[model samples]
Target: MSTSTISLDHVVAWLARFRELVTEQQSYLTELDSAIGDADHGANMVRGMNAVVEKVGAAPATAADELLKSVGMTLVTSVGGAAGPLYGTLFLRMGVSAGPVAELDGAAFGAALRAGLDGVVARGKAEAGDKTMFDAINPALDAWDAAVAGGADIAAAASAALAAAEKGRDSTEPLVARKGRASYLGERSTGHLDPGATSSTLLFQALADTVTS
Candidate 1:
Protein backbone atom coordinates (compact mmCIF):
# COMPACT_ATOMS: atom_id res chain seq x y z
CA MET A 1 0.00 0.00 0.00
CA SER A 2 2.94 2.30 -0.53
CA THR A 3 2.10 5.41 -2.55
CA SER A 4 3.64 8.73 -3.33
CA THR A 5 0.55 10.71 -4.15
CA ILE A 6 -2.84 11.40 -2.58
CA SER A 7 -5.45 9.59 -4.60
CA LEU A 8 -9.19 10.15 -4.63
CA ASP A 9 -9.58 7.39 -2.07
CA HIS A 10 -7.22 9.23 0.22
CA VAL A 11 -9.20 12.42 -0.12
CA VAL A 12 -12.38 10.57 0.74
CA ALA A 13 -10.72 9.04 3.76
CA TRP A 14 -9.52 12.48 4.80
CA LEU A 15 -13.06 13.76 4.72
CA ALA A 16 -14.32 10.77 6.68
CA ARG A 17 -11.64 11.11 9.31
CA PHE A 18 -12.33 14.82 9.62
CA ARG A 19 -16.01 14.11 10.09
CA GLU A 20 -15.27 11.67 12.87
CA LEU A 21 -12.90 14.03 14.65
CA VAL A 22 -15.31 16.97 14.47
CA THR A 23 -18.18 14.87 15.73
CA GLU A 24 -16.06 13.60 18.59
CA GLN A 25 -14.99 17.11 19.52
CA GLN A 26 -18.37 18.77 19.03
CA SER A 27 -19.12 19.41 22.67
CA TYR A 28 -15.60 20.45 23.48
CA LEU A 29 -15.69 22.86 20.57
CA THR A 30 -18.98 24.32 21.72
CA GLU A 31 -17.62 24.71 25.22
CA LEU A 32 -14.61 26.52 23.92
CA ASP A 33 -16.87 28.79 21.88
CA SER A 34 -19.15 29.53 24.80
CA ALA A 35 -16.37 31.54 26.37
CA ILE A 36 -16.00 33.83 23.38
CA GLY A 37 -18.46 33.09 20.61
CA ASP A 38 -22.05 32.07 20.02
CA ALA A 39 -21.38 28.55 21.28
CA ASP A 40 -22.16 26.81 17.97
CA HIS A 41 -18.70 26.14 16.57
CA GLY A 42 -18.76 22.42 17.37
CA ALA A 43 -22.28 21.78 16.18
CA ASN A 44 -21.77 23.80 13.01
CA MET A 45 -18.69 21.83 12.05
CA VAL A 46 -20.24 18.50 12.94
CA ARG A 47 -23.31 19.22 10.87
CA GLY A 48 -21.25 20.47 7.93
CA MET A 49 -18.81 17.58 8.15
CA ASN A 50 -21.58 15.03 8.36
CA ALA A 51 -23.12 16.44 5.24
CA VAL A 52 -19.73 16.46 3.51
CA VAL A 53 -19.23 12.77 4.31
CA GLU A 54 -22.74 11.83 3.34
CA LYS A 55 -22.28 13.47 -0.03
CA VAL A 56 -18.66 12.66 -0.78
CA GLY A 57 -18.74 9.18 0.75
CA ALA A 58 -21.87 8.09 -1.01
CA ALA A 59 -20.13 7.88 -4.34
CA PRO A 60 -16.55 7.73 -5.46
CA ALA A 61 -15.64 10.96 -7.22
CA THR A 62 -14.68 10.53 -10.83
CA ALA A 63 -12.45 13.57 -10.54
CA ALA A 64 -10.89 15.24 -7.51
CA ASP A 65 -12.76 18.44 -8.28
CA GLU A 66 -16.08 16.68 -8.17
CA LEU A 67 -15.61 15.47 -4.64
CA LEU A 68 -14.03 18.65 -3.37
CA LYS A 69 -16.68 20.79 -4.99
CA SER A 70 -19.39 18.68 -3.45
CA VAL A 71 -17.77 19.02 -0.08
CA GLY A 72 -17.44 22.80 -0.43
CA MET A 73 -21.00 23.30 -1.60
CA THR A 74 -22.34 21.12 1.15
CA LEU A 75 -20.44 22.93 3.84
CA VAL A 76 -21.53 26.33 2.58
CA THR A 77 -25.16 25.25 2.56
CA SER A 78 -25.38 23.09 5.66
CA VAL A 79 -23.13 24.80 8.18
CA GLY A 80 -24.15 28.09 9.73
CA GLY A 81 -22.28 31.33 10.52
CA ALA A 82 -18.79 32.26 9.42
CA ALA A 83 -17.50 28.74 9.83
CA GLY A 84 -19.60 27.54 6.93
CA PRO A 85 -18.38 30.12 4.44
CA LEU A 86 -14.78 29.97 5.55
CA TYR A 87 -14.59 26.19 5.56
CA GLY A 88 -16.60 25.96 2.39
CA THR A 89 -14.31 28.44 0.67
CA LEU A 90 -11.38 26.25 1.60
CA PHE A 91 -12.78 23.19 -0.16
CA LEU A 92 -14.03 25.21 -3.07
CA ARG A 93 -10.63 26.72 -3.65
CA MET A 94 -9.02 23.34 -3.26
CA GLY A 95 -11.37 21.91 -5.84
CA VAL A 96 -10.51 24.69 -8.25
CA SER A 97 -6.81 24.16 -7.75
CA ALA A 98 -7.08 20.40 -8.03
CA GLY A 99 -8.46 20.65 -11.56
CA PRO A 100 -9.75 17.37 -13.01
CA VAL A 101 -7.06 15.09 -11.60
CA ALA A 102 -7.78 11.86 -9.83
CA GLU A 103 -4.66 12.02 -7.70
CA LEU A 104 -2.31 14.69 -6.38
CA ASP A 105 1.40 14.42 -6.00
CA GLY A 106 3.05 15.97 -2.95
CA ALA A 107 3.79 19.21 -4.72
CA ALA A 108 0.34 19.32 -6.18
CA PHE A 109 -1.19 18.72 -2.79
CA GLY A 110 0.89 21.50 -1.32
CA ALA A 111 -0.18 23.89 -4.01
CA ALA A 112 -3.82 23.00 -3.47
CA LEU A 113 -3.49 23.37 0.28
CA ARG A 114 -1.85 26.75 -0.16
CA ALA A 115 -4.68 27.79 -2.39
CA GLY A 116 -7.22 26.66 0.17
CA LEU A 117 -5.41 28.56 2.89
CA ASP A 118 -5.35 31.68 0.76
CA GLY A 119 -9.04 31.34 0.12
CA VAL A 120 -9.77 31.24 3.83
CA VAL A 121 -7.69 34.34 4.34
CA ALA A 122 -9.43 36.14 1.52
CA ARG A 123 -12.82 35.25 2.91
CA GLY A 124 -12.05 35.84 6.54
CA LYS A 125 -9.68 38.80 6.28
CA ALA A 126 -7.79 37.47 9.30
CA GLU A 127 -4.13 36.77 9.78
CA ALA A 128 -1.79 35.04 12.18
CA GLY A 129 -1.74 36.62 15.68
CA ASP A 130 -5.36 37.51 15.12
CA LYS A 131 -6.36 34.71 17.47
CA THR A 132 -8.45 33.18 14.73
CA MET A 133 -8.33 30.00 12.63
CA PHE A 134 -5.65 31.73 10.58
CA ASP A 135 -3.27 31.21 13.45
CA ALA A 136 -3.43 27.44 12.96
CA ILE A 137 -4.00 27.41 9.22
CA ASN A 138 -1.12 29.71 8.34
CA PRO A 139 1.39 27.68 10.31
CA ALA A 140 0.04 24.41 8.93
CA LEU A 141 0.57 25.74 5.42
CA ASP A 142 4.12 26.76 6.22
CA ALA A 143 4.89 23.36 7.69
CA TRP A 144 3.26 21.55 4.79
CA ASP A 145 5.24 23.53 2.24
CA ALA A 146 8.48 23.00 4.12
CA ALA A 147 7.86 19.29 4.68
CA VAL A 148 7.05 18.60 1.05
CA ALA A 149 9.95 20.75 -0.12
CA GLY A 150 12.19 18.71 2.16
CA GLY A 151 11.10 15.61 0.23
CA ALA A 152 8.86 14.12 2.85
CA ASP A 153 6.15 11.77 1.75
CA ILE A 154 2.53 12.88 1.90
CA ALA A 155 1.98 11.09 5.21
CA ALA A 156 5.05 12.60 6.78
CA ALA A 157 4.21 16.03 5.49
CA ALA A 158 0.69 15.71 6.85
CA SER A 159 2.06 14.77 10.25
CA ALA A 160 4.30 17.79 10.20
CA ALA A 161 1.40 19.97 9.24
CA LEU A 162 -0.68 18.63 12.12
CA ALA A 163 2.07 19.27 14.62
CA ALA A 164 2.44 22.83 13.37
CA ALA A 165 -1.31 23.27 13.56
CA GLU A 166 -1.32 22.20 17.20
CA LYS A 167 1.43 24.63 18.01
CA GLY A 168 -0.48 27.39 16.29
CA ARG A 169 -3.67 26.44 18.13
CA ASP A 170 -1.91 26.60 21.48
CA SER A 171 -0.29 29.90 20.62
CA THR A 172 -3.78 31.37 20.44
CA GLU A 173 -4.49 30.95 24.15
CA PRO A 174 -2.70 34.08 25.28
CA LEU A 175 -3.62 36.42 22.46
CA VAL A 176 -6.50 38.79 22.71
CA ALA A 177 -9.04 38.36 19.95
CA ARG A 178 -8.62 40.68 16.98
CA LYS A 179 -11.32 39.28 14.76
CA GLY A 180 -14.77 37.75 14.64
CA ARG A 181 -17.31 37.56 17.46
CA ALA A 182 -14.57 37.10 20.01
CA SER A 183 -13.22 40.57 19.29
CA TYR A 184 -16.04 42.19 21.18
CA LEU A 185 -14.78 40.68 24.42
CA GLY A 186 -11.57 42.75 24.19
CA GLU A 187 -9.21 41.83 27.03
CA ARG A 188 -11.47 39.02 28.19
CA SER A 189 -10.55 36.96 25.12
CA THR A 190 -6.93 36.52 26.16
CA GLY A 191 -7.25 33.51 28.43
CA HIS A 192 -9.61 31.36 26.42
CA LEU A 193 -8.22 29.00 23.80
CA ASP A 194 -9.81 30.01 20.53
CA PRO A 195 -12.36 27.45 19.44
CA GLY A 196 -11.81 28.20 15.75
CA ALA A 197 -8.11 27.59 16.21
CA THR A 198 -8.87 24.35 18.01
CA SER A 199 -11.17 23.12 15.24
CA SER A 200 -8.68 24.12 12.58
CA THR A 201 -6.09 22.00 14.34
CA LEU A 202 -8.45 19.04 14.07
CA LEU A 203 -8.62 19.55 10.32
CA PHE A 204 -4.89 18.96 9.95
CA GLN A 205 -4.95 16.08 12.40
CA ALA A 206 -7.60 14.42 10.28
CA LEU A 207 -5.42 14.87 7.23
CA ALA A 208 -2.50 13.24 8.99
CA ASP A 209 -4.63 10.36 10.23
CA THR A 210 -6.04 9.71 6.80
CA VAL A 211 -2.63 9.66 5.18
CA THR A 212 -1.01 7.47 7.84
CA SER A 213 -3.93 5.14 8.39
Candidate 2:
Protein backbone atom coordinates (compact mmCIF):
# COMPACT_ATOMS: atom_id res chain seq x y z
CA MET A 1 0.00 0.00 0.00
CA SER A 2 2.12 2.84 -1.28
CA THR A 3 0.77 6.31 -1.83
CA SER A 4 1.26 7.59 -5.36
CA THR A 5 0.78 10.88 -7.06
CA ILE A 6 -1.87 11.36 -9.76
CA SER A 7 -0.72 12.64 -13.10
CA LEU A 8 -2.36 13.85 -16.27
CA ASP A 9 -1.79 10.41 -17.72
CA HIS A 10 -3.80 8.90 -14.92
CA VAL A 11 -6.67 11.25 -15.62
CA VAL A 12 -6.70 10.30 -19.27
CA ALA A 13 -6.46 6.63 -18.40
CA TRP A 14 -9.43 6.85 -16.09
CA LEU A 15 -11.46 8.59 -18.78
CA ALA A 16 -10.62 5.77 -21.15
CA ARG A 17 -11.71 3.23 -18.57
CA PHE A 18 -14.92 5.15 -18.06
CA ARG A 19 -15.60 5.10 -21.78
CA GLU A 20 -15.13 1.35 -21.97
CA LEU A 21 -17.37 0.63 -19.01
CA VAL A 22 -20.11 2.96 -20.19
CA THR A 23 -20.10 1.32 -23.59
CA GLU A 24 -20.24 -2.16 -22.07
CA GLN A 25 -23.01 -1.26 -19.63
CA GLN A 26 -25.13 0.79 -22.04
CA SER A 27 -27.99 -1.64 -22.18
CA TYR A 28 -27.95 -2.16 -18.44
CA LEU A 29 -28.23 1.57 -17.86
CA THR A 30 -31.08 1.85 -20.34
CA GLU A 31 -32.93 -0.98 -18.61
CA LEU A 32 -32.62 0.78 -15.29
CA ASP A 33 -33.97 3.95 -16.87
CA SER A 34 -36.89 2.17 -18.46
CA ALA A 35 -38.13 1.58 -14.94
CA ILE A 36 -37.94 5.17 -13.75
CA GLY A 37 -37.02 7.69 -16.39
CA ASP A 38 -37.24 8.42 -20.13
CA ALA A 39 -35.32 5.19 -20.68
CA ASP A 40 -32.43 6.95 -22.43
CA HIS A 41 -29.90 7.47 -19.67
CA GLY A 42 -27.67 4.67 -20.90
CA ALA A 43 -27.75 5.76 -24.50
CA ASN A 44 -27.14 9.34 -23.55
CA MET A 45 -24.10 8.44 -21.43
CA VAL A 46 -22.70 6.24 -24.17
CA ARG A 47 -23.04 8.98 -26.71
CA GLY A 48 -21.45 11.53 -24.42
CA MET A 49 -18.55 9.28 -23.47
CA ASN A 50 -17.90 8.43 -27.09
CA ALA A 51 -17.63 12.09 -27.91
CA VAL A 52 -15.31 12.60 -24.94
CA VAL A 53 -13.05 9.71 -25.98
CA GLU A 54 -12.83 10.98 -29.50
CA LYS A 55 -11.90 14.42 -28.28
CA VAL A 56 -9.32 13.12 -25.85
CA GLY A 57 -7.87 10.60 -28.27
CA ALA A 58 -7.42 12.99 -31.13
CA ALA A 59 -5.34 15.67 -29.45
CA PRO A 60 -4.22 14.34 -26.06
CA ALA A 61 -4.18 17.68 -24.33
CA THR A 62 -1.15 18.55 -22.24
CA ALA A 63 -3.08 20.09 -19.40
CA ALA A 64 -5.14 17.76 -17.22
CA ASP A 65 -7.64 20.39 -16.18
CA GLU A 66 -8.11 21.53 -19.76
CA LEU A 67 -8.68 17.97 -20.83
CA LEU A 68 -11.32 17.45 -18.17
CA LYS A 69 -12.93 20.77 -18.97
CA SER A 70 -13.16 19.71 -22.58
CA VAL A 71 -14.83 16.51 -21.48
CA GLY A 72 -17.34 18.39 -19.41
CA MET A 73 -18.22 20.75 -22.25
CA THR A 74 -18.60 17.87 -24.67
CA LEU A 75 -21.01 16.07 -22.39
CA VAL A 76 -23.01 19.20 -21.73
CA THR A 77 -23.63 19.70 -25.44
CA SER A 78 -23.95 16.05 -26.46
CA VAL A 79 -25.88 14.46 -23.61
CA GLY A 80 -29.51 15.16 -22.89
CA GLY A 81 -31.63 15.39 -19.73
CA ALA A 82 -30.44 15.75 -16.18
CA ALA A 83 -27.55 13.44 -16.99
CA GLY A 84 -26.10 16.06 -19.28
CA PRO A 85 -26.04 18.88 -16.78
CA LEU A 86 -25.28 16.79 -13.74
CA TYR A 87 -22.42 14.77 -15.23
CA GLY A 88 -21.15 17.80 -17.09
CA THR A 89 -21.05 19.77 -13.90
CA LEU A 90 -19.27 16.98 -12.12
CA PHE A 91 -16.40 16.90 -14.58
CA LEU A 92 -16.30 20.66 -14.87
CA ARG A 93 -15.97 21.01 -11.15
CA MET A 94 -13.38 18.25 -11.04
CA GLY A 95 -11.34 20.07 -13.64
CA VAL A 96 -11.59 23.25 -11.64
CA SER A 97 -10.60 21.46 -8.48
CA ALA A 98 -7.52 19.93 -10.07
CA GLY A 99 -6.42 23.30 -11.43
CA PRO A 100 -3.82 23.82 -14.16
CA VAL A 101 -0.44 22.05 -14.13
CA ALA A 102 -0.88 20.80 -10.57
CA GLU A 103 -0.23 17.16 -9.73
CA LEU A 104 -2.89 15.32 -7.72
CA ASP A 105 -2.00 12.62 -5.24
CA GLY A 106 -4.43 10.29 -3.49
CA ALA A 107 -5.61 12.93 -1.05
CA ALA A 108 -5.82 15.60 -3.74
CA PHE A 109 -7.79 13.30 -5.98
CA GLY A 110 -10.17 12.55 -3.13
CA ALA A 111 -10.60 16.24 -2.49
CA ALA A 112 -11.24 16.91 -6.17
CA LEU A 113 -13.88 14.20 -6.21
CA ARG A 114 -15.50 15.69 -3.16
CA ALA A 115 -15.56 19.04 -4.92
CA GLY A 116 -17.18 17.41 -7.91
CA LEU A 117 -19.79 15.90 -5.63
CA ASP A 118 -20.47 19.31 -4.22
CA GLY A 119 -20.94 20.61 -7.75
CA VAL A 120 -23.41 17.81 -8.39
CA VAL A 121 -25.30 18.81 -5.29
CA ALA A 122 -25.40 22.42 -6.41
CA ARG A 123 -26.52 21.57 -9.93
CA GLY A 124 -29.05 18.88 -9.05
CA LYS A 125 -29.92 19.92 -5.51
CA ALA A 126 -30.34 16.27 -4.59
CA GLU A 127 -29.26 14.58 -1.37
CA ALA A 128 -28.53 11.06 -0.16
CA GLY A 129 -31.51 8.65 0.13
CA ASP A 130 -33.15 10.53 -2.69
CA LYS A 131 -32.87 7.49 -4.92
CA THR A 132 -30.51 9.46 -7.18
CA MET A 133 -26.84 9.33 -8.14
CA PHE A 134 -26.11 11.50 -5.11
CA ASP A 135 -26.81 8.53 -2.90
CA ALA A 136 -24.03 6.55 -4.56
CA ILE A 137 -21.67 9.45 -5.11
CA ASN A 138 -21.85 10.86 -1.62
CA PRO A 139 -21.10 7.57 0.06
CA ALA A 140 -18.29 6.91 -2.37
CA LEU A 141 -16.70 10.28 -1.61
CA ASP A 142 -17.10 9.69 2.09
CA ALA A 143 -15.42 6.33 1.83
CA TRP A 144 -12.62 7.82 -0.22
CA ASP A 145 -12.08 10.51 2.37
CA ALA A 146 -12.13 8.07 5.24
CA ALA A 147 -9.78 5.64 3.54
CA VAL A 148 -7.37 8.38 2.61
CA ALA A 149 -7.47 9.74 6.12
CA GLY A 150 -6.66 6.26 7.39
CA GLY A 151 -3.47 6.33 5.22
CA ALA A 152 -4.74 3.88 2.62
CA ASP A 153 -2.97 3.88 -0.71
CA ILE A 154 -4.66 5.32 -3.73
CA ALA A 155 -5.63 1.88 -4.99
CA ALA A 156 -7.10 0.78 -1.68
CA ALA A 157 -8.93 4.06 -1.17
CA ALA A 158 -10.38 3.94 -4.65
CA SER A 159 -11.43 0.33 -4.12
CA ALA A 160 -13.27 1.27 -0.98
CA ALA A 161 -14.93 4.16 -2.76
CA LEU A 162 -16.12 1.98 -5.60
CA ALA A 163 -17.50 -0.62 -3.20
CA ALA A 164 -19.48 2.03 -1.34
CA ALA A 165 -20.77 3.38 -4.62
CA GLU A 166 -21.94 -0.06 -5.73
CA LYS A 167 -23.71 -0.70 -2.45
CA GLY A 168 -25.40 2.67 -2.63
CA ARG A 169 -26.46 1.91 -6.19
CA ASP A 170 -27.99 -1.36 -5.07
CA SER A 171 -29.72 0.27 -2.14
CA THR A 172 -31.66 2.42 -4.57
CA GLU A 173 -33.74 -0.58 -5.62
CA PRO A 174 -35.96 -0.64 -2.59
CA LEU A 175 -36.44 3.05 -1.98
CA VAL A 176 -39.19 5.26 -3.28
CA ALA A 177 -37.86 8.06 -5.41
CA ARG A 178 -37.58 11.37 -3.61
CA LYS A 179 -36.12 13.48 -6.40
CA GLY A 180 -36.10 14.01 -10.14
CA ARG A 181 -38.62 12.57 -12.59
CA ALA A 182 -38.77 9.27 -10.78
CA SER A 183 -39.96 11.07 -7.70
CA TYR A 184 -43.12 11.97 -9.53
CA LEU A 185 -44.08 8.30 -9.48
CA GLY A 186 -44.04 8.25 -5.66
CA GLU A 187 -44.22 4.65 -4.46
CA ARG A 188 -44.27 3.28 -8.00
CA SER A 189 -40.58 4.10 -8.25
CA THR A 190 -39.91 1.53 -5.57
CA GLY A 191 -38.28 -1.74 -6.65
CA HIS A 192 -36.51 -0.01 -9.56
CA LEU A 193 -32.89 1.01 -9.29
CA ASP A 194 -32.03 4.55 -10.26
CA PRO A 195 -30.28 4.56 -13.60
CA GLY A 196 -28.25 7.62 -12.65
CA ALA A 197 -26.88 5.90 -9.56
CA THR A 198 -26.00 2.80 -11.55
CA SER A 199 -24.01 4.88 -14.02
CA SER A 200 -22.37 6.80 -11.19
CA THR A 201 -21.25 3.53 -9.68
CA LEU A 202 -19.74 2.57 -13.01
CA LEU A 203 -17.87 5.87 -13.04
CA PHE A 204 -16.32 5.13 -9.64
CA GLN A 205 -15.48 1.59 -10.72
CA ALA A 206 -13.76 2.96 -13.78
CA LEU A 207 -11.66 5.28 -11.62
CA ALA A 208 -10.66 2.49 -9.24
CA ASP A 209 -9.83 0.10 -12.05
CA THR A 210 -7.83 2.61 -14.03
CA VAL A 211 -5.80 3.72 -11.05
CA THR A 212 -5.18 0.15 -9.93
CA SER A 213 -4.35 -1.01 -13.41
Candidate 3:
Protein backbone atom coordinates (compact mmCIF):
# COMPACT_ATOMS: atom_id res chain seq x y z
CA MET A 1 0.00 0.00 0.00
CA SER A 2 1.19 3.49 -0.84
CA THR A 3 1.75 5.66 2.18
CA SER A 4 0.35 8.77 0.47
CA THR A 5 -2.72 7.26 -1.19
CA ILE A 6 -5.85 5.45 -0.13
CA SER A 7 -7.06 2.59 -2.29
CA LEU A 8 -10.38 0.79 -2.35
CA ASP A 9 -8.79 -1.93 -0.25
CA HIS A 10 -7.86 0.71 2.31
CA VAL A 11 -11.44 1.89 2.41
CA VAL A 12 -12.63 -1.65 2.96
CA ALA A 13 -10.19 -2.18 5.77
CA TRP A 14 -11.19 1.13 7.30
CA LEU A 15 -14.81 0.03 7.42
CA ALA A 16 -13.83 -3.32 8.84
CA ARG A 17 -11.81 -1.71 11.60
CA PHE A 18 -14.64 0.68 12.32
CA ARG A 19 -16.98 -2.29 12.64
CA GLU A 20 -14.65 -3.96 15.09
CA LEU A 21 -14.25 -0.84 17.21
CA VAL A 22 -17.95 -0.07 17.30
CA THR A 23 -18.76 -3.67 18.19
CA GLU A 24 -16.24 -3.65 21.02
CA GLN A 25 -17.51 -0.30 22.28
CA GLN A 26 -21.20 -0.99 21.79
CA SER A 27 -22.14 -1.09 25.44
CA TYR A 28 -19.99 1.94 26.16
CA LEU A 29 -21.69 3.87 23.42
CA THR A 30 -25.10 2.92 24.72
CA GLU A 31 -24.00 3.98 28.18
CA LEU A 32 -23.05 7.38 26.85
CA ASP A 33 -26.29 7.73 24.93
CA SER A 34 -28.37 6.62 27.90
CA ALA A 35 -27.09 9.63 29.78
CA ILE A 36 -28.49 12.23 27.39
CA GLY A 37 -30.29 10.62 24.48
CA ASP A 38 -31.84 7.37 23.35
CA ALA A 39 -29.88 4.30 24.36
CA ASP A 40 -29.81 2.75 20.89
CA HIS A 41 -26.80 4.55 19.40
CA GLY A 42 -24.51 1.62 20.12
CA ALA A 43 -26.83 -1.03 18.79
CA ASN A 44 -27.73 1.10 15.80
CA MET A 45 -24.07 1.60 14.84
CA VAL A 46 -23.21 -2.06 15.25
CA ARG A 47 -26.21 -3.11 13.18
CA GLY A 48 -25.54 -0.51 10.52
CA MET A 49 -21.85 -1.34 10.24
CA ASN A 50 -22.57 -5.05 10.16
CA ALA A 51 -25.02 -4.54 7.34
CA VAL A 52 -22.47 -2.29 5.66
CA VAL A 53 -19.76 -4.94 5.83
CA GLU A 54 -22.08 -7.60 4.49
CA LYS A 55 -23.36 -5.43 1.68
CA VAL A 56 -19.90 -4.24 0.60
CA GLY A 57 -18.41 -7.68 0.91
CA ALA A 58 -21.08 -9.26 -1.29
CA ALA A 59 -20.83 -6.64 -4.02
CA PRO A 60 -17.33 -5.64 -4.93
CA ALA A 61 -17.02 -2.00 -5.90
CA THR A 62 -14.49 -0.93 -8.50
CA ALA A 63 -14.44 2.64 -7.29
CA ALA A 64 -14.27 4.29 -3.86
CA ASP A 65 -17.48 6.19 -4.52
CA GLU A 66 -19.39 3.06 -5.44
CA LEU A 67 -18.29 1.23 -2.31
CA LEU A 68 -19.07 4.10 0.05
CA LYS A 69 -22.35 4.92 -1.67
CA SER A 70 -23.43 1.37 -1.03
CA VAL A 71 -22.41 1.77 2.61
CA GLY A 72 -24.34 5.05 2.91
CA MET A 73 -27.45 3.55 1.38
CA THR A 74 -27.29 0.48 3.59
CA LEU A 75 -26.99 2.57 6.73
CA VAL A 76 -29.85 4.79 5.62
CA THR A 77 -32.16 1.85 5.11
CA SER A 78 -31.04 -0.41 7.92
CA VAL A 79 -30.18 1.78 10.91
CA GLY A 80 -32.83 3.64 12.84
CA GLY A 81 -32.84 7.09 14.50
CA ALA A 82 -30.75 10.17 13.73
CA ALA A 83 -27.52 8.20 13.35
CA GLY A 84 -28.82 6.54 10.21
CA PRO A 85 -29.47 9.70 8.24
CA LEU A 86 -26.47 11.60 9.58
CA TYR A 87 -23.96 8.82 9.05
CA GLY A 88 -25.63 7.90 5.77
CA THR A 89 -25.27 11.42 4.42
CA LEU A 90 -21.64 11.50 5.54
CA PHE A 91 -20.72 8.46 3.48
CA LEU A 92 -22.96 9.53 0.62
CA ARG A 93 -21.20 12.85 0.30
CA MET A 94 -17.78 11.26 0.70
CA GLY A 95 -18.55 8.99 -2.23
CA VAL A 96 -19.75 11.88 -4.33
CA SER A 97 -16.68 13.94 -3.53
CA ALA A 98 -14.38 11.01 -4.16
CA GLY A 99 -16.04 10.45 -7.53
CA PRO A 100 -15.08 7.22 -9.35
CA VAL A 101 -11.49 7.09 -8.25
CA ALA A 102 -9.74 3.81 -7.57
CA GLU A 103 -7.36 5.66 -5.22
CA LEU A 104 -7.30 8.92 -3.36
CA ASP A 105 -4.13 10.84 -2.59
CA GLY A 106 -3.95 12.69 0.74
CA ALA A 107 -5.46 15.94 -0.54
CA ALA A 108 -8.29 14.16 -2.29
CA PHE A 109 -8.99 12.11 0.80
CA GLY A 110 -9.14 15.28 2.90
CA ALA A 111 -11.52 16.84 0.41
CA ALA A 112 -13.73 13.78 0.58
CA LEU A 113 -13.73 13.96 4.37
CA ARG A 114 -14.57 17.65 4.28
CA ALA A 115 -17.41 17.01 1.88
CA GLY A 116 -18.75 14.36 4.20
CA LEU A 117 -18.71 16.78 7.13
CA ASP A 118 -20.46 19.39 5.03
CA GLY A 119 -23.10 16.86 4.13
CA VAL A 120 -23.62 16.05 7.80
CA VAL A 121 -24.04 19.75 8.52
CA ALA A 122 -26.50 20.11 5.70
CA ARG A 123 -28.46 17.10 6.79
CA GLY A 124 -28.46 17.74 10.54
CA LYS A 125 -27.98 21.48 10.86
CA ALA A 126 -25.16 20.90 13.35
CA GLU A 127 -22.42 23.37 14.11
CA ALA A 128 -19.44 23.85 16.38
CA GLY A 129 -20.35 23.45 20.09
CA ASP A 130 -23.62 21.74 19.19
CA LYS A 131 -22.56 18.75 21.28
CA THR A 132 -23.05 16.60 18.22
CA MET A 133 -20.86 14.46 16.00
CA PHE A 134 -19.77 17.63 14.31
CA ASP A 135 -17.70 18.47 17.38
CA ALA A 136 -15.46 15.48 16.80
CA ILE A 137 -15.57 15.37 13.01
CA ASN A 138 -14.84 19.03 12.44
CA PRO A 139 -11.71 19.13 14.56
CA ALA A 140 -10.56 15.83 13.13
CA LEU A 141 -10.90 17.07 9.57
CA ASP A 142 -9.08 20.27 10.44
CA ALA A 143 -6.21 18.26 11.89
CA TRP A 144 -6.20 16.03 8.82
CA ASP A 145 -5.95 19.03 6.54
CA ALA A 146 -3.23 20.61 8.62
CA ALA A 147 -1.18 17.45 8.63
CA VAL A 148 -1.54 17.10 4.89
CA ALA A 149 -0.59 20.75 4.39
CA GLY A 150 2.52 20.12 6.45
CA GLY A 151 3.50 17.37 3.97
CA ALA A 152 2.43 14.41 6.08
CA ASP A 153 1.48 11.17 4.40
CA ILE A 154 -1.92 9.53 4.71
CA ALA A 155 -0.97 7.51 7.78
CA ALA A 156 0.41 10.54 9.59
CA ALA A 157 -2.62 12.60 8.71
CA ALA A 158 -4.93 9.88 9.92
CA SER A 159 -3.05 9.69 13.23
CA ALA A 160 -3.34 13.43 13.68
CA ALA A 161 -7.03 13.26 12.89
CA LEU A 162 -7.60 10.50 15.40
CA ALA A 163 -5.79 12.38 18.13
CA ALA A 164 -7.77 15.52 17.45
CA ALA A 165 -10.97 13.55 17.31
CA GLU A 166 -10.29 12.01 20.73
CA LYS A 167 -9.72 15.45 22.11
CA GLY A 168 -12.90 16.69 20.50
CA ARG A 169 -14.83 13.76 21.88
CA ASP A 170 -13.59 14.40 25.40
CA SER A 171 -14.29 18.11 25.08
CA THR A 172 -17.93 17.34 24.46
CA GLU A 173 -18.37 15.97 27.98
CA PRO A 174 -18.81 19.33 29.63
CA LEU A 175 -20.81 20.96 26.88
CA VAL A 176 -24.56 21.43 27.11
CA ALA A 177 -26.41 19.88 24.23
CA ARG A 178 -27.74 22.11 21.49
CA LYS A 179 -28.73 19.53 18.89
CA GLY A 180 -30.23 16.09 18.48
CA ARG A 181 -32.01 14.25 21.29
CA ALA A 182 -29.33 15.37 23.70
CA SER A 183 -30.50 18.93 23.21
CA TYR A 184 -33.77 18.05 24.86
CA LEU A 185 -31.86 17.74 28.14
CA GLY A 186 -30.59 21.32 28.03
CA GLU A 187 -28.15 21.88 30.92
CA ARG A 188 -28.86 18.43 32.21
CA SER A 189 -26.90 17.12 29.22
CA THR A 190 -23.62 18.34 30.69
CA GLY A 191 -21.05 15.96 32.20
CA HIS A 192 -21.83 13.15 29.78
CA LEU A 193 -19.92 12.33 26.65
CA ASP A 194 -21.81 12.67 23.40
CA PRO A 195 -22.38 9.23 21.95
CA GLY A 196 -22.17 10.63 18.44
CA ALA A 197 -18.80 12.19 19.18
CA THR A 198 -17.50 8.98 20.74
CA SER A 199 -18.53 6.97 17.69
CA SER A 200 -17.17 9.61 15.39
CA THR A 201 -13.83 9.33 17.17
CA LEU A 202 -13.92 5.62 16.51
CA LEU A 203 -14.41 6.38 12.86
CA PHE A 204 -11.13 8.28 12.76
CA GLN A 205 -9.37 5.74 14.95
CA ALA A 206 -10.36 3.10 12.42
CA LEU A 207 -8.90 5.18 9.65
CA ALA A 208 -5.67 5.60 11.53
CA ASP A 209 -5.40 1.91 12.23
CA THR A 210 -6.13 1.00 8.62
CA VAL A 211 -3.62 3.34 6.94
CA THR A 212 -0.84 2.69 9.44
CA SER A 213 -1.14 -1.06 9.33
The prediction achieving the highest TM-score against the true structure is: 3
Q: Ranking by lDDT, best first?
A: 3, 1, 2
- TM-score of model 3 relative to the true fold? 0.98
Worst ten in a row by lDDT for model 3: 1-10
What are the TM-scores, per candidate, against the unseen true structure?
0.97, 0.96, 0.98
Best-matching candidate per lDDT: 3
lDDT of 2 by residue, 111-181 (tens): 77888889989988888788999989999989998988898888898899999999999999999998888
In angstroms, what RMSD does candidate 2 have relative to the true structure?
1.3
lDDT of 2 at 158: 87
- Regions more than 4 Å wrong, model 2: 1-3
Runs with alpha carbons beyond 4 Å of true place in candidate 3: none
Better of 1 and 2 by lDDT: 1
For residues 46-135, write the lDDT of model 3, one tens digit per residue.
999999999999988999999989999999998898999999999999999999999999999999989999999999998899899999
**Error in Å for residue 80 of model 1:** 0.8
